[model samples]
Target: MNRREWGLTTLAGLTGLALPRATSAQSAGTGRGYRYVHLDVFTDRRLAGNQLLVFVQPAGLDTDAMQALTRESNYSECTFVWPPEQPGTDHRVRIFGRTAEMPFAGHPTIGTAFALAHAGVLKPAMSKTVFGLGVGPTHIDLEWKGRQLAFAWMTQLKPTFGKTVDDAGGLAAAIGLEKDAVIRPAQEVHTGSTFLIVPLATRKAVDAAVLDRAKVDAVLTAAGVQRRGLYVFSTERGQDDATAYSRLLGSGGIEDPATGSAAGPAGSYAVKHGLVPSDRAASIIFLQGVLVRRPSRIHVNVASAGSEIASVKVGGTSVVVGEGSMSV
Candidate 1:
C-alpha cells in the first residue's frame, strides 16, 4: 500500500498486528529498558480524554531511537528523559514525534507532570508546580480527581501571533470548500509550536473537510509554513464555556484528536478577533476531539491587560490508562 493510501484512510485503517514490536538487538536486562505510564488528559471522565505514553526515567535512549519509538507508537507525541532526573538532577524532559523533537506539546506536558507527581518527584504546591522542559520551565497544578491524579491548571508558554498567510482561498478550494468558507488570511499562532489558524464557516464545514496531503503540502510549501499549518475549526455558535467546540487537523500526515498547544493559541486568536468578551483575562473551556471521537476538553485562559494583550494558559485533566516495561 502507498503512503497516500494511508493518508487518505481514516485512523481505523492502521489498527493491526503491525504496530508494536520488540527489536531483537537489545536484551530486556540492559540498563536500557523503559517504563510506561498511561495518561488520560483534558477531561475528568475516563476514556473521554487525550491518551499519553509516559516513559519514566528513560535515561539511556539516544535521539534517533527515541524519535523512532514515537513513530512506532504513532501517537500524537511522546516524551523521554536523558539523565532521568534523579534525587537532585534537573529533569530534562524531551518531546518527540515521527519527525523531530517538538519544543512543547500540551498533553505530553500534562502527562509528564502527572507522572512526576505520582512518582513523588516534584514538590507539591497548593496552586501549581513549575516543571522544567527542554524548551523551558512550565507550571502545572495537580489535584486529586476522585482518587486519581489530575491537573487542575497548567500555565503555557508565551504566545507568538505572526503573519496571516495570504492563501486562505487556495487552501479552502483545495479542501473541497468554497473559497469564502476559509477564514481570511490564516494567522500563525503559537504558545509552544506555531499553527496556522484557518477558521471554517460552520461545524458542517469542519465535518466535511477533505484536506488532501498533496494540496496542503503544495499550499504550505508555497507559503513556506512547512512542518506546521495545523487546521482547527469550532462548532461554537455563540461562545460560552459548555458551547466552545473545536478540532485540530494536521496537514502533515498526522491528526491530533486533542491539541492543547494549538488550542491555547486559538484562544489567543479568539481574543484578538473579539470573539470572546475580554473580562480581565478569563479562563474558558474548549471542547475538542468530538468529530474525531476522542472527546477532549481543554481549558484556556486569555489575559488582556487593557488591550495590551497578555499570557495564554491551557491545561487539562489526565488519567493513567496503561503501562508497560520496554527493553530499549
Candidate 2:
C-alpha cells in the first residue's frame, strides 16, 4: 500500500472503536469498522472518470473525522451513508471534498447509491433511491439489467443564477487563456453548490488551459463569486462531435474528472445564454478530465418549459474498482 492507503488502513482500525457496530464482516452480527467501496463515476470503463470513496455505514465518524478521512483518500470527493432521518427516504448521504464538507455534490451521491445497491443494502427492485442530503431530498433513479444495477440518474435541485463576470479580459487571465479565448462572460450558477461557468473559444483552449490560483481568486473576489469551483467548456467537444469539452478546476489546483454538480448549472447557463436550444428537452454531453488522463463523460439533460427550465438531471454509469473497511 502507498502512504495514503496505509494511513487509511490504520485509521480504519481506529474507526471500529469510534463508531457503533452496524454489522460484522459482510453479513450477520454487529460490526465496528465501516465498509467503504471505491468506484469510478461518469464512465462505464474502469480507471476513467472521477474516483469516489463511499463509506457504506458510517455510524460514528463526526465532521472532523470525515474531513480527515477525505483528505487521506485524496480523491475528488468521499461520501458517508447513514440511515435515513426522515420518512420516505432510502438513505442519508454526506459528501466531503479533500479539505472540507460539501452540502451537495454530483458524483458522490450517484456513486454512493450505486455502492449501496451493489452491496445489497439498497433493494434492486426499487426504481428510485432518495438520499437526504444537506441541500434536501435528492432522488436518484435506478435501472436494473437482470438483478444487477445497470445505471443511475440523479434529479438535481433547481438552478439558481448568481453573479456574472462581465470582465472577460480579467477572467481569461485568471485561468491561463487569451482574451479572445473566452467565448462567453463568466457566470455563477448554482444547483446545490455554486460554480463559475466559463465558455471557451475552442477545445484546444480548454485542453491547454492552466489555472493561476491568484488570478482566479482575484477575479472571483472582484465579481463577488463566492463559490471557488471553475468550470470551463468548449463547443468543439472531445471524443465525440456532439460532446462539449469541459474541465472543472478546484481551489487546490485539482481538476475534476467528471463534475455532475457543475453540469447542472452549466446546462442552465447554456440555455440562459442561447448557447444551446432550450425549446424542448435538451442533452449536452460533457467530456472532462482528459488532460489529467482520467477521461470522463457526463450526460447532462435539461427540460425546459418555454423560457424557464423545468428540471435538470445528470446521469452516468459507474463500476466498482475496490472495497475495504475504514475504521473511525
Q: What is the lDDT of every predicted structure here? A: 0.71, 0.83
Using TM-score, give the best candidate's number.
2
Model 1 clashing residue pairs (backbone)? 40-318, 40-319
lDDT of 2 by residue, 1-328 (tens): 8999999999999887866645556456434677799999988888999999999877788899889888888887999998888787778888998778888999998898789888897677789989999888898989888878888889998888888888888888777778888887888888887888998889888877778888878887888777467889887644574557888865555667889999888878887888776652366778887888988878788887777788889888889999998664
Candidate 1 regions exceeding 4 Å error are 1-32, 81-90, 122-126, 144-148, 217-227, 238-243, 251-253
Q: Which pairs of residues collide in candidate 2?
A: 12-327, 15-327, 15-328, 23-31, 24-31
Steric overlap count per candidate: 2, 5
